[model samples]
Target: MLVQGETTFEDCLVSLNVLCDVLLTVAKLMYPLPEFVLIHKDESVLKDIESLENFRLNVYKVTLSQDCELYDVELHTEPNYPTLGKKFGVKSIAEKIRQMTDTDIEKLLSKGESESPLIIIDDVPIESEGVHFFFRVVKQTQFEAIAKQGCVVLLDYTADAALKDEGRIQEITSRIQKLRKEAFFYVNY
Candidate 1:
């Protein structure tokens, strides 16, 4: 497990980038691995394309898989990417107040202190925004995505539901081969 180089110990444990790359290449040659591994942001409620794309790009930087067919720089933004908007802060008010009616502004301002729980900063209610990242491992035609955050390298292994059936099939095939080898049929008969 020791990599002889100037790499840090933390990099050795968390990253092991070069080793993982080599092992993944070898694994592909040694066994039937997935053809594609997709790293994507988790389920998003944002409707903004710019924001979503930016977040996905950030995720691509932290992802650790390489040499897979699913590795694409633009895959994160392929289907859709949401935009960014000011939610409930001064920015929201400044930007949206012009589009809102007088009644709408009044209603927002006249809400009771106990009306709803709000996170306020500088006396302005600011909406919270967050995005989760997920990994999708695809083998042949099957694929499933699992949500996670930060880095999503090893976490994809246990979350690959698409590979479970293949694993069982491989196991059964191996067992049947073993049984066939054990059985001596009429070869010369």
Candidate 2:
């Protein structure tokens, strides 16, 4: 799973492509055995894949349930006219996402099964103090209540320059490497 964030659509596409390449390389190196790799997303990034070569992975474009779709009001504006309408307030966006999440939870419960090992690639920064509160509420109210569920929430912070600087990237990469090594050690133990 890869999440990408940027002020411009092109930047987001570049970040996503880079992340995809990294993931593909890691998978190839770690697992020599043949395995299926799938890419799932909305149709937004379809054209961007034409530039990526050497990875023979199947891509699936599925429209998420209306409730599951996290709408970004920022993306709705025309390039020349960017204004937050009264209806497009931050509170409104949060409410919309929450409503959609609730609907998804209901649908999952009705099916009598859960989507285990579910990965959510959110282009939004989950570490923001304001957003963290909302995420905790969502997890406690809806996600955690679901049974037999495992979630990997990958947050992309490329939108913020401070978070994507060389030093920060190196720090994040080191932490991720440490986590992977620890997991491997535990598995081998």
Candidate 3:
């Protein structure tokens, strides 16, 4: 997002707003929608996914790989926690996490969780292989009617560029599928 090295916070805010608008535009083009809202610093959206109306379509929660950076670990101690609650922010840090390279993360997965002991409570050490920001999905169980209508709900936390790139990929995939069906391919085998 800071590609051009903007010199002011105002520039950053404006950039973020522009990014959100672009993302919404891309999402709308790719997905069917009755409504879409761009929320800034809003947590109310996470309360209940089932209550959300999904344009008479099935909603699915898609989870991708964990993305973490050096600043990502700083949420453990900050103004963010005192106001937003501990659970609202990333709460733990592993040794070398701030300095760990992508190669390090990949090597960690290959080895095991035994290396990084994250926390200790009541004198017992709690081990963590790695830290990740988890995005959990709340299903719409109460609305049987909406479920039958095919409402797919998705929440993504990727960068704006990544989102746009993925949307384009989805568009290509959809076109390929459409062409495949149009060619009269048999389902057998």
Error (Å) of candidate 2 at residue 180 is 33
TM-score of each: 0.20, 0.17, 0.22
lDDT of each: 0.38, 0.33, 0.39
Q: Which ten residues in a row have the lowest lDDT in candidate 2?
A: 72-81
Supply candidate 1's per-residue lDDT for 130.
15
Off by over 4 Å in 2: 1-30, 36-40, 50-128, 132-189
Model 1 TM-score on a 0 to 1 scale: 0.20
lDDT of 1 by residue, 1-189 (tens): 556777777877767787786665434421234432433343232223334444423122233343334542211111011212333333443444234443443344345445552234345543322111123344433333443432233222232554655555665676567777789543454
Candidate with top lDDT is 3
Question: Over the stretch 1-189, how does candidate 3's per-residue lDDT look in tens digits?
Answer: 556655688877998999997776455645322232222122344334335544343223422121223112111211223322333333433333444454554454444556654434334343452244221123432211111111222333333555556557777777678778999875787
Ranking by TM-score: 3, 1, 2
- Which structure among the candidates has the greatest TM-score? 3
**lDDT, model 2, position 18:** 93
